[model samples]
Target chain A: MNIQTKSQFVAVASITSELSAVMVVAKEISLAAANAKAIAFRAGDKAKGFQPITDFINELAKETIDLVTNINVYALSLYRLTVNEYRRTVAYNKFDLVVKTTEGVTYAQSMQAPLENAKISMQNCQRQFKRDVKQLLDQLEAVMHHARAARVIAANSRIEASQAGEYLQSLQAVAESVDKAAHTIHDNVQRCRIALSLYRNS
Target chain B: MKMTKIYEGSYQWIMFGRDANKPSNIIDSNQYAVRTANRCLLLEPGGSELFAPMMAAVLHHTPVDQITDLFASHQDPDVISSLGLWDQALSNAKLHAPAIWEGYLRHFGCESIEYVPIPDNGGTIKLDSVELQLIPAHYLHSPGNFHVYDHHAKILMSGDVGSAVEAPGAPMYVDNFDSHIEKMRYFHQRWMPSNQAKRAWIERVRNLDIDILAPQHGRVFKGDDVKRFLDWFDSLQVGIAV
Candidate 1:
C-alpha cells in the first residue's frame, strides 16, 4: 500500500474512536438534565425559568446521541469502502504490470480489456470514497452544531440557577456538568471532522 | 518465468516456474496450465507475488477470458494465494478446490469465480474433451489436499508429495534420481505430517500408470524417475517432528 492509502485508512478508523467519546459525553449531559429538572421542582417558583432550560438540555443531548449513533454506522461503512478501494487499486496495478511484461508476445492484446476494467473499478471506488467522506463530514458538522447550542443552554442554565436560594449550589453544579460535557462533545466531534476533512469531496 | 510443455496431443499441459524476477524471500512454486481447444485450466496458479509473471507467461499460450478454470491443491498460500487477483481477472472461471477448504480458501477473495468443491473421495474436471481426475492426497502436507491426474496424458500433478526445495534457476526435470534424494528428504520428512497418510497416498498412486509426476515445487519427474520417486518416498519415515 502507498503512504496516502495508509493515511486514508487511519483517518477513517480514527473517526470511530473520537466519536465514541462524544457519545459518552452526550449521555452524561442527558443525566445532568434529569438532575437539574428535579432540583427545579424542589425550588418551586424560584426555579420556574430553570425547569424549561432543563428540558432543552435533555432534548439537545438526545439529538446529539442519535446523530452520533448514525455517524458511527456511516464510519463503519467508510472503513469497508477503504478496504475495497485498496483491493481494486492493487488489482489494477498488477494488471498494468502484466501488460508491460507481455510487450512483444502473442495474445498480449487480450489483456487490454481486464486492464481497462480494473482501472474503471478502481476509479469508481475512489469517487465513492470521496462522496461518502463528504456526507460523514456533514454529519460531524451537525454534531458540532448541537455542541454549540449546548454551551449556549449551559450559560442560560447558570443565570437561572442564581435565583434559587437553598437549591442554588445543586443547580449550579448541574450547570457546570452540562458545560463540561458540551466542551467534550465539541472537542471530540471537531477531531473527527479534522481527520475526515482531507478526503472530503472538495 | 520458464514454460515447459510436458504433454501435447489434442490438449496441452504446460508447466510454469523458475521465475528469474521472483523475490528472494518466498519459496519457488510451479504453476501448470491445461489448454484445450476453447478453454484452459490453471492448476496451482501460485502465490500473489507470482501473479504478474505467471499471467504474462500464460498469456503467451491463452487469453484471459479463455482461462476458465482454476484448481487449488489445498488452502496453502503458496498454492493459491493469488486467487483474489484471478477472481477479479477471470469473470467466468470456476475454482475446483477441496470441499473442506471452500470456506478457508474464500479468505483469499473468490467473489466472481464459481467454486466447484471437490468431495473427500475425489472428483473430475472436464475441460471440453479432456477429463482430468482429482485424486485425494489428504494430509500429504495439508489436511484437505488433492492432486490432478490425466488418464489420457499419463501425467499426475502431485501437490507436494514429490516436491523438493531447489535453488533458483534449477533444472525443470530431475536429471538424476539418486543425487536428488537429499534435496527432497528433509522437506518431506519435516512437512508431511502423517506416516499413515503418506503410505495410503503411495499405495493409491502406484495403481495409476503415470509417465510424468509434476509436483508444485522443485523438479518434474519423468519416465522411470516417477517410479524412483515413489519407491524413495515409500520407505522414508514421515511425521518425524512429533
Candidate 2:
C-alpha cells in the first residue's frame, strides 16, 4: 500500500475511536441533567427556570447519543469499502503489468476486458467512499449543533442556580459538568469531521 | 517466467515457473495450465507476487475469458494466494479446491468464481474432452491436500510430494535422481507431517501409471525418475519434528 492509501485506512478507523469518547461524554451529560432536576425540585419556586433547562439538556444528550451510534455503524461500513478499494487497486496494477509484459504475445489483447473491468470496480469504490464521507460529515454536523445548544443551556442553568439559595452550589456544579461534557463532545466531533473531510467529494 | 510444454495431445499441460524477476525473499513455485479446445484450467496458480508474470505467461496459450478453471492443492499461500486476483479477472471461472478448505481459502478473496469443493475421497475436473482426477494427498504437507492426475497424459501434478528446493534458473525436469536426493530430503522430512499419511499416499500413487511426476515447487520428475522419487520418499521418515 502507498502512503495515501495507508492514511485513508487510518482516517476511516480513527472515526470509531473518536466517536466512542463522544458517546461516553453524552451519557455523562444525561446523568448531570437528572441530578440538576432533583436540585431544582428541592429549591421549588426558586429553581423553576432551571427545571425546563434540565429537560433540554437531557434531550440534547439523547439526540447526540443516537447520532453517534448511527455514525459508528456507517464508519464500520466505510472501513470495509476501504479494504475493497485497496484490493481492486492492487488487481488493476497487476493486470496493467501483465499487459505491458505480454505486449508481443499472441493473446495479449484478451486481457483488455479484465483490465477495464478492474479499473471500473476500483473507481466505483472510490466514488462510494467519498459519498459516504459526505453523509457522515452531515451527521456529525448535527452532533456539533447539539453541542452548541448544550453550551447555551449550561449558561442559562448558571443564571437560574443563583436564585436557588441553599440549592445554588449543587445546581452550579451540574451546570459546570454539562458545559464540560459539551466541550468534549464538540472537540471529538470536530476531529471526526476533519479526518473525514479530506475524502469528501474529492 | 519460464514456460515448458510438458504434455500435448488433445489438450496441453504447460508449466510456468523460474521467474527471473521474482523477489528474493519468497520461495519459488511452479504453476501449471491445462488448455483444451475452448477451456483452460490453471493448477496451483501460485502466490499473489507471481500473479503478473504467471498471467503474462498464460496469455501465450489462452485468453483471460477462456481461463475457466482454477485448482488449489491445499490452503497454502504459495499454492493459491493469488486466488483473489483470479476471482476478479475471470468472471466465470470455478475454483476446484479441497472441500474442507472452502471457508479457509475464501479468506484469499473468492467472490466471483464458483468454488467446486473436492470431497475427501477425491473428484474429477472435466475440461471439455479432457478429464483430470483429483487424487487425495491429505497430510502430505497440509491436512486437506490433493494432487491432479491426467489418465490420458500420464502425469501427476503432485502437490509437494516430490518437491525440492533448487536455486533460481533451475532446469524444469530432474536431470539426475541420485544427485537430487539431498535437495529434496530435508524439505520432505521436515514438512510432511505424517508417516502413516506418507505411506498411504505412496501406495495410492503406485497404482497410477505416471510418466511425469510434477510438483508445485522445484524440478519435475519424468520417466524412471518418477518411480525413483517414490522409492526414496517411501523409505524416508517424515514428521521428524515431533
Candidate 3:
C-alpha cells in the first residue's frame, strides 16, 4: 500500500525500475544488431543493403536507452524531494504536537514562532514536490516520445529489409527482432506514462 | 563509500574512502572516523561534493550526534571543504585543525563549529575516554597539515603521507608493494614539495608503532607494508620541479 505522502514517489520509483528493465531489452537489441552487422560484413557485397538496417536498429536502441536513462535521473530527483517532504512533515508534526500539548506554558509561547516557521517550511517542501513531480512527468513524456521515434526507426528498418529481395533473407530475422525490442521500449514507456498520470491525478 | 576497520579496541579506527559513487570530476580522497562508545571523531572528511554520501556512510557505523569532533589535515578542499555542512549537521561538534589554516577554512562556511586550533607542534584530542594525537605534518603537501595517530589502536591516520592516484574501486589495502609504487610515485614527487619536510615527517613517524599506515587518498599499508612504505618513501627524492 502506498502512503498518501509518498504515493507519487512510489509510482515514479516503479517507473524508473521498469525503465531499467527496458534498458536490458535495448542492450539485447543492440547486441543482436551488432551480430547482424558482423554477419553482413562477412557476406560482403551480398548483404550490402542489410548492413544499413542493422546500423539503424543499433542507433535506435542506443537512443532509446539513453533517453530512458535520462528520464530516470528526473525520477531520482522526485524520489529525493519526496523523502525531504516526508522528513519536513514529520518535523512539523512533532513540533505541532508539542505546541498543542504545552499550551499556556512560557516555553510553548516561545515555540509558537518556530512551529509556525516549520509549518511554512513544510508547505514549501510540498510545493516543491508538486513542481518537481510535474517536471519529472514532462521528462517521462519526452522519453515516451523518443521511444515512439525509435519504433518509427524500427519500422523503417523492417521496410528496408523487405526491399532487399532474395539477397537479404537473413536480415528479416534481425529486422523483426529490432521491431519487437522497439515495441517493448515504446510499450514500457507508455505504461510508465500511465502510472505517472495516475499519481498526478491522485 | 567503502569503510574498513583498521583497528579494533574500546575505541575503533575506521577508514572511509574508495567511494565509487563520488563524482569523477573531483579527485578521489579518503575520510576516516574514530568511533568510541560515546563519541565519534571524523578526520579529513573530504569535500562539499561528498558531504551527503559520506554522512550516509558514517551513519552505517555511528550516529550523527555522537560525532563530537572533526579534524581536518589542512585547508585543502579535498580534506575538509565539507566542514560547513558537517557544522550544520553535528551540533556541539568542535573542529580541531591546524591554527594556521583556521582563518582560511572559515571561508568553507564553518559558522557553527567551535574551531579548536592545534598548535604548530600539535595537540591531543581526548574524545570521552579515547585520546588521539594530532601529530604535525607540516608541508608534506599542504602548508599546515596534521595527521591523527590513535595510540591504543596502533593506527596512524597519515594524511597524504602515503597517498596514491589509483583508479576508483581499487582494493582497500596494498596487496603488492612493488606494483603500488607507480601509483604513488608521480603523486608524491609532484605534490609533495620539500624533500627536507618529507625526511622530517618520516623521521618523526619512525618512532611510532604504526601497525596500519592509513593515508587520505589510497590504500592502507598494514603489517610489513608499513615499513616497506616508510623505507620506499625515504629513498624517493621529492620536490623536483621540472
Candidate 4:
C-alpha cells in the first residue's frame, strides 16, 4: 500500500477503536444511572431532592447511548468507503503498468468514455464519505454534550446523596461511578474528533 | 503470477503471468518487463484481476517504484485492465501507447502518469541506455497496436500480432510449429480484421533481425519457427469474420 493509503487506514482504525471505547463508557454510565434511581426509590421521603438529579442522569445516559449508536452506524459506513477508495487506488496502480510497458505514444490516451462516468461516480462516493464523516462527528459531539450534562447531574446527585443520611455511602458511590463514566465518554469523543481531522486533507 | 528471467546481463527481460491462482473464467495472459539499470519498462501488464499477483511477482524481482514506463499494445482488457492500479503504485511512471486509444484507455483511471502519445508512425524510447523501438502493428486486432523491439537481444515483443489462443497450462514456447498452428489460426483470422493491414505489418516485421518472436499469448517462437510463422501467416487469409 502507498503511504497515503496507510495513513488513512490508521486514522480510520483509531477513530473506530475510540468510538468503541465510548460505547463501553456509555454502557457503564447507564448501569450507574439505574443504580442511582434504585437508591433514590429506597431513600423514599429523605432522598426526595435527589430524585430529580437521578432522573436527569438517567435521561442523559439514554441520550448518550442513542447518539453513540447512531455514531457507530455512520462510522461503519465511513470504514467501508475508505476501504473501497483504497482498493480503487490499488487497481489504478496495477493497470498503469500497461502504459509503462511500451514507453511510446498512446493513441486514445484522453478518450475515457467509461472512465468519465466512473470518475463522476467515484467523486460522488467521496463526497458522501466526507458528509458521513461530518455527520459522525456531529453525533459524537451530541453524545459529548450529553456526557457533560450527565457529569453535572452526577455532581448534584452526590451532593443530594450526602444530604440523605440513610443511603449516603451507596448513593455517593453510584454517583461517583456515573461521573467517571461520563468523563471517560467525553474524553473518547474528543479523541474521535481529533482522529477524524486526519481526513480533512482528503 | 510468476516472473521468470528471460534474459540477464546489462539489461533484463522478465516474463510475468500464466498465474495458477487466476480465476478459471478469464483468459490467461503473459506480461513482460524489460529492465535496465536506471529504468524498467512493463509491457501489456494485463487486466485488473492480474494486478495483485503480478505486483507480487514483480516485487520479488524489483521495487515497485523502479518501474518507469508502461506500454499497452491496444485497449483490450487482457492487455491493459490493470492501468488504474499501476497508476496508484507508480506515480512517477509514464504511459506510452498508440495515440488513437488515448481517450479510451484513460477511462482505466490514469490520473498520475504523464502520457507520451505514440503516433501512428511509431517511435523509439530510451530506457536509460538501451533504445527500444515502438514498431507499429495497427489492426492486428485493435485499430491501434504496437510491438516493442530490442535490437541487442534481437527479441520482438509482438503484442497480439503472433498471439495464439491455447488452452490452460500450455507450454511457454512453441516446440512444434506444425501443431501450434491450430492454436493460432482462428484467433488471427477472426481478430486480425484486415488482411491488407496484416500483410503490411508482416512485411515490415520480416525485415527486422529477430531471434525470438515473443507474443502476448500462448508461446514464444524461436529460430526457424520465426520464419515458419511469417511464411505461414503471410499465405493465410485473415479478417474472415463477416
Per DockQ, the best of the predicted structures is 2
lDDT of 1 by residue, B63-167 (tens): 899999999999999999999999989989999999999999999889999999999999999999999999999999998999999989999999888899999
Question: Which residue runs does candidate 3 get wrong by more than 4 Å?
Answer: A1-202
Worst 10 residues of 1 chain A by lDDT: A193-202
Query: In model 2, what lDDT does residue B104 have?
Result: 97
- Please give the RMSD of candidate 1 to the true structure: 1.4
DockQ of each: 0.84, 0.91, 0.01, 0.05
Q: List TM-scores of chain B, every candidate.
A: 0.99, 0.99, 0.97, 0.98
Model 3 CAPRI rating = incorrect
For model 1, what share of native contacts is present? 0.76
Q: What's the candidate order when arranged by decreasing lDDT?
A: 2, 1, 4, 3
Global lDDT of each model? 0.94, 0.95, 0.79, 0.80
After superposing candidate 4 on the true structure, give the runs of residues whose Cα lies further than 4 Å from its correct spot.
A1-128, A132-202
Off by over 4 Å in 1: none
- For model 4, what is the error of residue B231's alpha carbon versus the real structure, in angstroms, after optimal superposition? 0.6
Q: What range of 10 consecutive residues in model 3 chain B has the weakest lDDT sum? A: B83-92
Better of 2 and 3 by lDDT: 2
- CA lDDT for candidate 3: 0.79
Clashing pairs in 1: none
User: What are the fnat scores of the candidates, in the order listed?
Assistant: 0.76, 0.90, 0.00, 0.10
Error in Å for residue A159 of model 3: 85
